[model samples]
Target: MKLVRKTIFWLHLGIGLLAGVLVLMMSVTGVLMAFERQIVEKADGFHITATGNPLGPEAHLDGLRTAKQPPSSLGFERDATRPVVYQFGKEKAVFSDPYTGKSLGNGNTAVRGFFKFILSWHRWLGREGASQATGKAIIGIGNLMFLFLLVTGVFLWFPKRWTRSGVKAITLLQKRLKGRARDWNWHNVFGFWAAIPLLVIVISGTVISQPWATTLVFHLAGETPPVQGERKKPAPFTLPESLAGLDAAFATVKSSNPDWQSIQLQLPFAKTATFIVADSHRGRPDLRRTITVDLATSGIVKSEGFDDLGPGRQTRTWIRWLHTGEAGGLPGQTIAGLAATASAVLVWTGFALSFRRFFKKRRAAA
Candidate 1:
């Protein structure tokens, strides 16, 4: 039994040392992203007055079509104070007033850039193209190792005999301790308390990073995983002289859900493409709704709510919310942030201990 415990301890230490830097980068980025949505919204400075009645979706599209370069999509803000936004190409966006369809300059590029930079590092280690794929693979593997470290760390943190002193040593930090002893106590205590939430965060992250794990999630949920690249091709048709269909699709979705927090209308990529409307509920991404409309007929093709999702898709959605700590609102975000911060500390302390042990052994050999 003692030998088994020793093996687990050494395995934990070795894995921690190997993956510590990547884990630390991920942890720090996770901490930053905990409040990213809120921070970005505030930084965007997209405010408008609610005095005048807002124009209908069609009218807004008509206004946006007059831009020097037509936008590929339109975003409607549910908040009356916020202006409508038009997305051009992939990353550029323009803001406009909902009341009069008047231009309000560009969307918040600085905030968008900041978040994009952070997300690139968080998701792909700031790499691009083939390197990005390699980065994601590394992050996925590191997340699994991180989960393993958490489990082994808990085992290592268990009290030897369950005595009061032993329990305290594992559960509480001793403030009076200095240098290595302080770090040791802090690492153990923080790891013990943070094990559960950290487990959840890492598991969800792993599931998202690995395609096989995603399939496993669906299988466990009693549903068939969707096959990749199996979308039905749109029926061939002629392009309309105007974007009247886009407005009609938006109106259809908005009329059904009057309380929608925001709506994004994706323009047809091809003449046969369907117009897609994403109606997101305020602060509740899981509850966001989707609608598809035929490009030729301006008729509703399909509309889906959160409850309409299959078990597999629903589970994946919930996993995303859980991973980001948004499912539980502010308190959940706070917990996730603390867990990430603690994880960073754990990496730091683990390296410190390993180096100390290495030097001590070298001196002893000398």
Candidate 2:
């Protein structure tokens, strides 16, 4: 039993040290991203009062199509006050009033840049192209290590005997401890409390980074994973004489869900394409309602609500919400943010204790 405990301790220490920097970066960036949407909204002055007399989707489509280079997609803002967003070829997007077809200009660049930087480092270690791919692979592997660390950390936190005193010693931080002892207590106490949320966050993160994990999720849910590029292609057809179908399709979805908070329309690139509408209510993105319309016929191809999704897909959506704490709204975000902050502390304390022990061993040898 003693040897087993020692082995687990060494394994925990080794893995933690190996993945410390990557985990630290992820935790710090996660803390920043926990409230990112709110910050960006504030920075961009996003609030707009809706005018009941808004124009139809066709006008917005025309306005975007007539631009210097036509946008590949158009996102209709469900909020009557907000401008519809037109996304050009990757990375370029502009907002225009849905009622007037007038440009509202791009949003605050500085704010966008700030979030972009955070996201890049959070996912790709601030690398680009091939290096970014490599960084992502590293981060994914490190996340696995981090997940293992969480499990072993709890095991190491367990006291020799299960008693009221033993429980209190591990659960509460001792104020009187100094140096190494203080760091050890801080690491264990925080680890014990932060374990569950961090585990959820890490597992969700791994699911996102690994395709096999996603497949496993689907298998567990008793559903087959969707194959890539398997969407049935629409029969070849020409552009409609008038883009009235776009407006008609938008109305169909809006009339169905009158209380939808926002609806983003993705204009199809092919002559035979489907208009993909992403709907959400009350700022809860995890509860997205998707409606697909055939461009050729302007007919509703499919309308899927959150509840209508198969277990595999539904689990995927929930995993994303869990990772970002969007599932629980503001309170969820607060908990996820706090967990990330505690994780940073755990990394710091772990490093401090490891280094102190290392130096002490060397001193004793001398």
Candidate 3:
């Protein structure tokens, strides 16, 4: 038992040191993005009137046509009073009047751009083109190591004998802890509290980062997994010739989900329009629904919600929402943010302790 603990201790310490920097980058960025949804929502002003006739996407786009670049997509906010927002790409966005379809200039561009920048670093280390793939690969490997550290860390945290002092050290904050002792206590305390949420965040991120993790989700659920990266991404900014489908698509989706809190149309220059509605922004997966409307015939095509997904696919979907803490809503995001903050501190203390051990050993030998 002692031998096993020693082996795990060394492994945990070694892996944590190697992956500590990558973990720090992800954790700090995660903390920054935790309240992103709510902040962006408030910044853009999404207020849906309980009673009012809101204009369609075409009405909103009417004013934006004279812009330097045509909007790639147009979406309806939760309420009629709010302006409809359109995006040029991931970063640039413009809001238009719901009544006149004229451009209301732009909505929260800095905040949106800031979040996008943080997200790029978090997922791909802000690398672009072919190098982004390299960034993703490194991050994925680092994530795996972090997961290992988390598992072994819990084992190492448990004491051989649970005395009152030992329990307090693990579960309580010791006073006036200095230098190496301070680092040790901080590492254990932050790790002990953040362990659960960090596990969820890392595990879900693992599922996202690795294709095998995704396949495993399906295999465990006894369902056939879809082929990875099979779908060819269509040109993002392709503007449709006709804005006629937007109204029909929005109306059909609204009828399907009368109690829907928000809806956004993924503008595709196609015979059908896809509308995604949610009970809250970036949260509540169960209350979320995707409805497709046939633009040509102005008929309801198909409506699918969380309940409609198969168990395997549902679990797969849950992995994504869980990673972003969207499945559990605001409380989930808050926990994730706090855990991420704890992770940054963990890395700091871990490095501090490691440096102390090495220097202390050298000094003693000398």
- lDDT leader: 3
1 against 2, candidate with superior lDDT: 1
What is the per-residue lDDT of model 1 for residues 103-185, given as tens digits with 9 covering 90 to 100? 88775678778878888888998998779889899899999999999999988887779899888987888989887888899
Q: What is the lDDT of residue 234 in candidate 2?
A: 42
Give residue 313's error in model 2 in angstroms: 2.2
State the local distance difference test value for candidate 1: 0.80
In the range 94-197, model 2's lDDT, one tens digit per residue, is 87766666777787778878888999999988998779878888889999999999998888888899999778877899999999889988998899889999
The residue ranges of model 1 lying beyond 4 angstroms of the native Cα positions read 66-69, 88-90, 229-239, 243-252, 269-286, 292-301, 361-366
- Residues 268-311 of candidate 3 have per-residue lDDT tens digits of 55788877888665556777888778987778878888898888
Q: Provide the lDDT at 101 for model 1.
A: 82
Query: Cα lDDT of all candidates, in order?
Result: 0.80, 0.79, 0.81
Relative to the unseen true structure, what is the C-alpha lDDT of residue 273 in candidate 3, on a scale of 0 to 100?
Answer: 80
Arranged by TM-score with the best first, the candidates are 3, 1, 2
Top TM-score hit: 3
